[model samples]
Target: MRVIDKFKMFSIGPLVPSAFSDGNDPKDKSFGCELFDKSEKNYHQWLDSRPEGSVVYVSFGSLAVLKKEQEIEILRGLLESERPFLWTRRKGEDEGKKKNLEYDDVIIDEKLGLIVPWCSQMEVLCHKSIGCFVTHCGWNSTMESLVSGVPIVGYPQFSDQTTNAKMLEEVWGIGVRAKEVEGIVKREELKRCLGILMENGEKGEEIKRNVKKWRILALGAVKIGGSSHDNLKKFIEGL
Candidate 1:
């Protein structure tokens, strides 16, 4: 079994360049992640409490932990920047235990921030006023950010997030990752990355342009005769 694990079972080069490829692997079915239309709920009233052209959205991906210290540091950084923010604090039931830890609440003062246990992520991203994201770089979050055409401040926690960060910053020209990793994030680096992502700087302009191109490609991929649509047809036929 160990020796078998070391062998190459298939090729993946042809699949890399195409937005959709004819691959029979089970993973192929999930390639086109859907983006939903706006929700009916009136969460915008809450989100609009912050000023237009401001407000950052901060959230680690589902199942990721926000260490208590890391949470505090993130709060401090956001406060210091003086930008209005809508943050999502993890509140779901613990997977391994039913008990819950008390989350810090002192930082939610109205001068700068609003902290919700959980926010409607897709809806918030699609909102016109949201300026940037402080994200964990999960594929779902990454896809949402791309689809929304927003730049990100990547705070990759684990798994493929680090790789996704590389693509966003280096390859796709979309976002920047925080300098702080593990442990606690610092105020200065947080402010710096936020500035680059939100300001009228060259870096920000470049990312905005690139992300627009990506949005166009994403649409093309989903339309009829596009790679993603064709892949869907082939997938159903295989069944």
Candidate 2:
């Protein structure tokens, strides 16, 4: 079936598969493994240290890689937002060269922003302080953010991300598309998008309200008689 068809099935008043998290099974705990509390002391410390509603989480999922220039542009945009942010920049494959080290060598303000190789995304979303998510619109990450009740600033770059962005911005009303970055987003466009996302605008408030509605739908989908829950039960019984 087509992705759209599947999405329709899933949304037909709760009888479709429950694609709840970044996991094969809805209940899988280790699908996208997170740090233990003891091991993530630094992350936890940073979270605790920030003022409430002061940070944005920026991530592009696991498979996507940013060019050095792309990474720098993204950093510049985040810095321009003037709001604290948490960004994840994984080690690049071609980082043996010194040019790549520029990405590695750059220092971010510990108080305003934190960059890491990976992070407990679910945990981060659930935090009260996170006001917005600048995401690449991967379905798993999208679901995680909605479930956690946070709104998104969609910066779609590929494949399903475009579709997910549409769902968030159009259907679910939980996000805003950075249309200023038409075709592809650049640093300046990102800055504008982030500004609107962080600001208290009429559109942003609408997105927030719509996101809450979607959150209820998501939860209902996993409840006993919900579509996702029923589908899972049927599949298991068949197995």
Candidate 3:
């Protein structure tokens, strides 16, 4: 709600990229360094090989780190869910600060999962194979997942993330928040949340439907002649 003041305020935007847009591009906006682009495996091809809505995508973003125990729980949970997953653990982490935990060294069955240092996040989220995201609940990631119509398993670390998780789960009804004990989200709990999202259950289906609804709504708002597009045009005309 905008307050009535001397300066007018008009709501405009949620300009999601082409995955959820009627834009000309067949892809969402992508900008990344060539190093990540030239990774050994074609991550995009990997995504293409999987069944639609079958992959679990996990990333803690670049800055967040888990306790060694937490990392173990997360890894086990993903395996326990028995869903194919793609996980990214940013390379060159500060090992000292991370308490000597090395995520890259962990072995995963190639058939079950793949771990990479970096990839195009927006592109990954937009891919049809992504059924769910295990994320830190950062705002950008949250929006990308919603636009892609993928559900979430929020493992928020700090700041606005906690609140963002609440909105994603409680307000939007699009996902579930992992319960933690002594600052650690246990393996069983993580697996339980994953099941709630990926299993053929009432809650899972509801969340999927809600996220799909948001995707359509977001796409509708940004298309030509839509509310957001018209708002921008009107603003420009007034200038």
Best by lDDT: 3
Worst 10 residues of 1 by lDDT: 8-17
In model 2, the runs with Cα more than 4 Å from the true position are 1-41, 92-106, 180-184
Higher-lDDT candidate among 2 and 3? 3
Q: Deviation in angstroms for 230 in model 3?
A: 3.1
Q: Give the 10-residue window scoring lowest on summed lDDT in candidate 3.
A: 92-101
RMSD of 1: 8.3
lDDT (10s digit) by residue, model 2, range 108-147: 6566677766777776776767888989898888988887
* Number of backbone clashes in candidate 3: 0
Tens digit of per-residue lDDT, candidate 3, span 72-105: 8888888888888887766443331232234566
Error of 2 at 112 (Å): 1.7
Best by TM-score: 3
TM-score, cand. 3? 0.84
- Per-model TM against the reference: 0.75, 0.76, 0.84
Which tens-of-lDDT digit does each residue in 1-239 have in candidate 1? 66535652221121121333322112222223333322232446757665655888887856788776777788788888888887765543331121222345542544456555555676677666788999999988898678667789998888999999989999999889888754566878899998987788998889889888886676566556666667667666656
Q: What lDDT does model 2 reach?
A: 0.69
- Cα error of candidate 3 at position 193, Å: 1.0
Which portions of model 1 show Cα errors greater than 4 Å? 1-42, 49-51, 91-107
